[model samples]
Target: MSTPLSATFRAILMRDIRLAWSQGGTGTMALSFFMIAVTLFAFGVGPEPQVLARIAAGVIWVVALLACLLSLDRLYQADYEDGSLDDLALSPLGLTGVAAAKILAHWLATVVPLILIAPLLGMFMNLAPEGYGILLLSLLVGTPALSLIGSIGAALTVSVRRGGVLMALLVLPLYIPTLIFGVGAVDAAMGMVGSSANLALLGAVTLVALAIGPFASAAALRLALE
Candidate 1:
């Protein structure tokens, strides 16, 4: 029997995830890039623990953002090139579902490891014990917005050859709000007053991104396919 809608959605999600895993070192590459970026930040800033602690939240978020950019060009470009996107669009799940599934898969493949590793790296930057939980929570809340907004850039530029630069220019500005609230939440957890407010605002940004991303990406894909 053919799969149900929910099953189809799960299949799409898993398929991309599996492909991402099998593709030589994609997940590891993003993680390595993230770690290296943070390490370099440490080197450049010198070894003052207090300074590191004060900047840990921003540094992690900034490096995470740049690492995300590394993978965006390939998000839909491979499928677009290989005609898989065309096939996906023809599936009963439709293009919007396809976009949503792809974005989720990207998040799982690229951002999840960052979330897992951020705490350890934060410790290197002198993140307080109390800050670890909030760092993870903030990233959990914020990283989805990165993938969702990124997919819009990926979709919008799916047709342009070597469009990574253009996509970055278009998408990085949109990322500022997420980055701000992400750092804010970590700061709050470390004793900044009003952090709960930051967390709420971060979650709100993610919700808005999720609400609009799939539809925007799907529409852009249709335009490119035409």
Candidate 2:
């Protein structure tokens, strides 16, 4: 019997999750890196609580972006190597669905862990309590867009020899706007001046990515595979 599109998507998502889980260190590695990065930032910037708190939102957002980049190489490398990419291309579900499923899976594996660990990392950075809720909320909405946008980079570089570094180079520039808005939202929650426009712009970016990223990524993947 043929599989339904929804079933195919679920299967792909579940497979990616199981692979990520069994690998056992992706989440831990990201969380540890996040904590370490924040801690180092605190030391490098001085231990003043006020100073740390002042830069907390930017610090957290920067760490999250780095963490996301750390795992992006895995987004398509394993599949491409094991010929799963080829099979996905041949599947009836189409490349766009495959790209979306992969992006969702990457978000679940990478972004969600960052969100869950953000509060603990925030404490290290002396982030204000009132800002934590908004920081988490903004990241929850914004990180999926990061994964979606990064998917295009992953797809474009999947066949490249130095794909991981290349993927980072390609995606980091794209991430600046999302990072700006994400941190802006948290800063706004902290009563900083001129943050509402940034938060609204972040939401707008998420909506635009949701509308367009999958198709763009799918096209990239198809071209790479061809």
What Cα-based lDDT does every candidate model obtain? 0.90, 0.85
Ten contiguous residues with the weakest lDDT in model 1: 19-28
lDDT per residue as tens, model 1, 14-129: 98888777856357788989999998988999999998988998999999998887787788898899998898999888899999998999999888988999988998899878
lDDT of 2 at 89: 89
Runs in model 1 lying further than 4 Å from the true structure: 192-194
RMSD of each: 1.2, 1.6
Q: Per-candidate TM vs. native?
A: 0.96, 0.94
TM-score of 1: 0.96
Looking at model 2, the pairs that clash are none
Q: Which one wins on TM-score?
A: 1
lDDT, residue 193, candidate 1: 77
**What root-mean-square deviation over C-alphas does model 1 reach?**
1.2
How big is the positional error of residue 160 in model 1, measured in Å on the Cα after superposition? 0.5
